[model samples]
Target: MPELPEVETTRVGISPHIQGQTLHQVVVRDARLRWPVPTDLAANVEGKPLRRVVRRGKYLLFEFDHGAIIGHLGMTGSMRIVNHEEPPAYHDHVDLVFSGVTLRYRDPRRFGCILWQENPVMAHVLLASLGPEPLSDEFDVAHLLRACKGKKQAIKSLIMDGKQVVGVGNIYANEALFMAGIHPHRQAGRISAERLDRLVVCCKQVLSAAIKQGGTTLRDFVDSEGKPGYFKQQLQVYGRAGQACVTCDQHLTESRLGQRSTVYCKRCQR
Candidate 1:
């Protein structure tokens, strides 16, 4: 699935081409996505100019005059900019046609969504309860400590919870925890305030780095320009379970937490 970095990457990549451009048309090759593409999508957006593309967590908001189009790049979904005359291929499900180019959406698994919402797009149920963005000032040490209060969930799981802090997906969580020297299975409430503070800084650092590198392309992730991310090559503990730790010489360990694969260096992370 495309996480925060991936989603942000797509937003930035496509914004240059579509921002301030008039929407020429809305073409829906398949309306059967995670949810049905809004039946009146064209009526709402076809003639309006796209004001901007903003990202909240993993969802992208295509802002216009009266409303916004909410899009999610689910497990196998991606958006790319193609010439207006380019032919649609298999899995290419939707297109927001513009004067010069088309923003095409493709989803092999159809788990993504394209929906229309009126003003105050954030109030939609899908986004109403989401936590702060990991890179924002709202997701600081103090905020995390409060969420951790009296919680017995594993620190990794707590951080991964959308209601606690959005966009700390499994991969970034592992990397951030390793950077902070916190074990993935540690109790959230049992962690020291100082350590949690460091964890907050590390999470921001890791996420910023991933976004700078165009996100980690474990699989099925590409920028709006169709280029794969290069961050995976720099991973320390997320996928190198049996490999040597980058910090300590000890071998990294792998386990399943919340049913997601977790890799850590036991010697480096307490």
Candidate 2:
């Protein structure tokens, strides 16, 4: 699935082309996505100018005059900008045609969603209750420490919780924990405030770096320009299960935490 960095990259990549352009049409080749595409999507958006594109968690918001369109790039979904006359690919499920270009949404798994929000988008069911954005000032160490209090869940699972801090997905979570030198299985409440502070900084560092590199492309994730991310090459432990640890030269270990693969260095991390 596309994480926060990938979603942010997509938002940045396509924003310039679509912003300020009026929606010419919305073509839905397949409405059976994670949720049914609204039957009146075109009627709702056509002729309205796209004000801006922003990302919250892993969802992309295309803002217009009266409301915004929310999109999620599910397991294998991606968005790209192309010429208006460009032929659609086999998996291109939706297209938002603009004046001179088309914003295409392609998904092989059909788990992505394209929905409309007529009210304050932040209060939408899918967005409500989400934690602060990881890169924002609201997600500092003080905030994380408060959220960890009285929680006995594994630190990995705690940080991955969308309600605790949004957009720390499996890949970034593993990398952040490794960078913070904190064991993934450590109890959240047991961690000292100082270490939690370090963890917060590491999360921001890892996520900011990932976004700078266009996001980690483990499988089908790509920016809105259809470009694969380069951050995978800099990974320290996420997928380096049996490889030697870069810091201590010890073999890294792997386990399943919350049904997600977690790789860590026993010597480097407590």
Candidate 3:
């Protein structure tokens, strides 16, 4: 799935083209996404000016005057800005047409969603319980330490929890833990406050770097320009299973945690 960085990159990439532009039309080729595309989406949003595009965790918000459209780029979904006259591809499931350009949503798996929200967006069911943004001041060391209290879940799982700290997905969690020298399976409450501080910093650093590099393109992720991310080249542990550890030259170990593949340098972590 497209994580925080990839979603943020898409938000940044499509903003300039659609912001302040009136929605000419909304074409939903398939309404059977993760959830049915809101039946009244086009009726409610067409002709309204799109105010801005923003990201919360892995969801993208297309803000307008009265409400917003929420989008999730599931395991293989992507958004791109293309010319208004461009033809839709086989996987192009939705298009938000504008005067001069079109914002296209393409997803092969149909696991993504495009929903409408008429209430306060933050209070919406999909977003109401989400944790603080990883790159924001709300995710400081003190906040993380407090959230970690009395929790026995693996530190990696804790960080990946959207309710604990949004947007620390599998890949970034591995990279951030490796950067902080924390083992992936360590109990959250057992970690020291000082180490938690380092982990917080590493999370922000890894996420910021990933966003700067256009996100990690493990498979289907791509920027609005349809370019793959470059951060995969900078990964230290996420997918380096059986590879020599860069720090100690020991073979990195791989395991399954929460059904997700985890790679770590045993000697370097813990």
Q: What C-alpha RMSD separates each model from the true structure?
A: 0.8, 0.8, 0.7
By the lDDT metric, which is better: model 2 or model 3? 3
lDDT of 1 by residue, 151-209 (tens): 89999999999998998999999999999999999999999999999999999999999
Which regions of candidate 1 fall more than 4 Å away from where they truly are? none
Clashes of each: 0, 0, 0
Off by over 4 Å in 2: none
CA lDDT of every candidate: 0.94, 0.93, 0.94
List, residue by residue over 101-158, the lDDT tens digit for candidate 3: 9999999999999999985888789999999999999998899989999999999999
Instruction: Give the TM-scores of the predictions, in the order they appear.
Output: 0.98, 0.99, 0.99
For candidate 2, write residues 1-270 as lDDT tens digits.
Answer: 789899998998999999999999999999999999999889999999999998889999999878899999999999999997889988999999998999999999999999999868788999999999999999988999899898899999999999999999999999999999999999999999999999999999999999999999898998888889999999999899999999999999999999999999999999
Candidate 1: residue 112 Cα off by (Å): 0.7
Model 3 off-target regions past 4 Å? Answer: none
